[model samples]
Target: MDKGMFWAVLAALLVFSLIVATVGGVRDAIVGYVMQTSLQHAQRDMAAAAVRQRAEAARQRAQEAARQREALQARTLAPDQQCVSGTVVTVRSNDASQLIRGGAPVRCSGRLAEVPLR
Candidate 1:
C-alpha cells in the first residue's frame, strides 16, 4: 500500500477504536449507577420493614399488659365473701398516731359486689 493510504487507514482504525471504548465506558457507568440506586431502595425497604415489625411487637406487648390489668381488675371485682384479719401496719409516725387514735389491730369483713363489665 502507498504511505498515504496506509497512514489514512491507521488513523481511521484509531478513531473507530476510541469510539468503541468511549461507548463501552458510558454503558458501564450507567449500569453502575442503576445498580447503586437499586441497592439503596432495597436497603430503605428493609429498614421500613424492620420498623413495622418493631411497632407491631410493641403493640402486642401493650395489648397483653392491658389484658392482664383487666383480668386483675375482674378478679378484684368478683363477688366473694371473705373475712380479713390483720394488723394495720403504720408507714410513718403520723400514720401510726392516726391508727392509735382509731384503735390497733383492726379487723374487717366484707363481700365485694359483682361489677358489670362495660
Candidate 2:
C-alpha cells in the first residue's frame, strides 16, 4: 500500500509541473508579441513626424519666395531707371541648399528695369 501511494503522488506531481510549464511559455509569448507591436507603432509615428516636418519646411519656403518676388517687382517698378540697369542682388534662402547657404552667393545677372512714370 505504501509503494502504491508513492507512485500515485509522483505521477500527480509530474502532471502539475507540465501544466505550469505550458502556462509559463504561453505568458512569455504574449509578452513578446505585445513588445513587438509597440515598437512598430513607435516607428510609424516617427516616420509621420518626419514627413510633417518636411511639409512645414516647404510651406515656409514658398512664403519666402512670394515675399522676394514682391520686393523684386517693387524695385523694378521704381521711377529711377538707372537704379535697376545693372543691379546685382544676393538671394538668401534656407531651402537654397547646404552648398548655397554657407556664405555662398549666387550672382544673378538680371536687372530691375524701371517702369514709366504715369
Candidate 3:
C-alpha cells in the first residue's frame, strides 16, 4: 500500500471518530431538553387538575345551598295561601318541588296539606 493512501485513510477514520463524539454530545443535549419539557408539562397538568377539583367542590357547595333554600321556602306557607279547615288544600308551585311536611296532609294554618310527590 502507498504511504500517502494509508495516511489519508487514517485521517478519514480520525475525522469520523470526532464527528461521532460530537453527535453523541448533541444527542445528550436533545434528550435532556425533552425530559425537561416533559416535566414542565406534567407540573402544568397537575396544577390544572387541582383548579378543576376546586371548582367542582365550589359547585357542589352552591348546589347544597340552593337545595337548603328551596326546603326552607317550601315549608313556610306563602302570604296568599290561607288554609281553610274541612277543605282539601292543594298547594301548587310552578317548580313542582314543594316541601310537604308529612305523609298525612299537613295542616299549614288550619286545613290539611296535600301529600308531596317527592
Candidate 4:
C-alpha cells in the first residue's frame, strides 16, 4: 500500500473506535439512571405499604376496643337481685348498684351476700 493511504486508513480506524467507546459509555450511563429511578420508586411503594398496614392495625385495635366496651356495658346489672360475697357485678340485672369502692358504682351482676342489696 502507499504510505499516504496507510495513514488515512489508520486515522479513520482511530475515529471509529472513539465513536464506539463514547456510545458504549452513554448507554451505560442511561441504564444506570433508569435503574436508580426504579429503585427510588420501589422504595416509595414499600413505604406506602407500610403506612397502610399500620393504619389497618390501628383501625382493628380501635374496633376491638369498641367491642370490649359494648360487652362491658351489656353486663351492667339491675337492683333487687340477691348477691353473695365476692359475687362480681357482671351477673346482676340492674344499672345502679351499691358502691364497691370509693363511690364507684358496681356495674356487675352479683354482689356480696352479707352486703345490703342496693
Candidates in order have lDDT scores of: 0.61, 0.61, 0.68, 0.67
- In angstroms, the error of model 1 at 17 is 1.1
Cα displacement (Å) at residue 27, model 2: 0.8
Candidate 1, residue 73: the lDDT equals 63
Among all windows of 10 consecutive residues in model 3, the one with the lowest summed lDDT is 109-118
lDDT of candidate 1 over 1-118, digit per residue (tens)? 9999999999999999999999999999999999999999999999999999999999999999999777656434223223233322234434432122234443322322133122
The TM-score ranking, best first, is 4, 1, 2, 3
Best by lDDT: 3
C-alpha RMSD of each candidate structure in angstroms: 10.7, 12.6, 8.0, 8.3
| TM-score-superior candidate, 2 or 4 | 4
Tell me how candidate 3 scores on lDDT.
0.68
Clashes of each: 0, 0, 1, 14
Per-residue error (Å), model 3, residue 102: 7.9
lDDT of 3 by residue, 35-58 (tens): 999999999999999999999999
Model 1 gets an lDDT of 0.61
Residue 12 of candidate 2: its Cα lDDT?
Answer: 97
Q: TM-score for each prediction?
A: 0.64, 0.62, 0.59, 0.67
Q: Against the hidden true structure, what lDDT does model 2 obtain?
A: 0.61
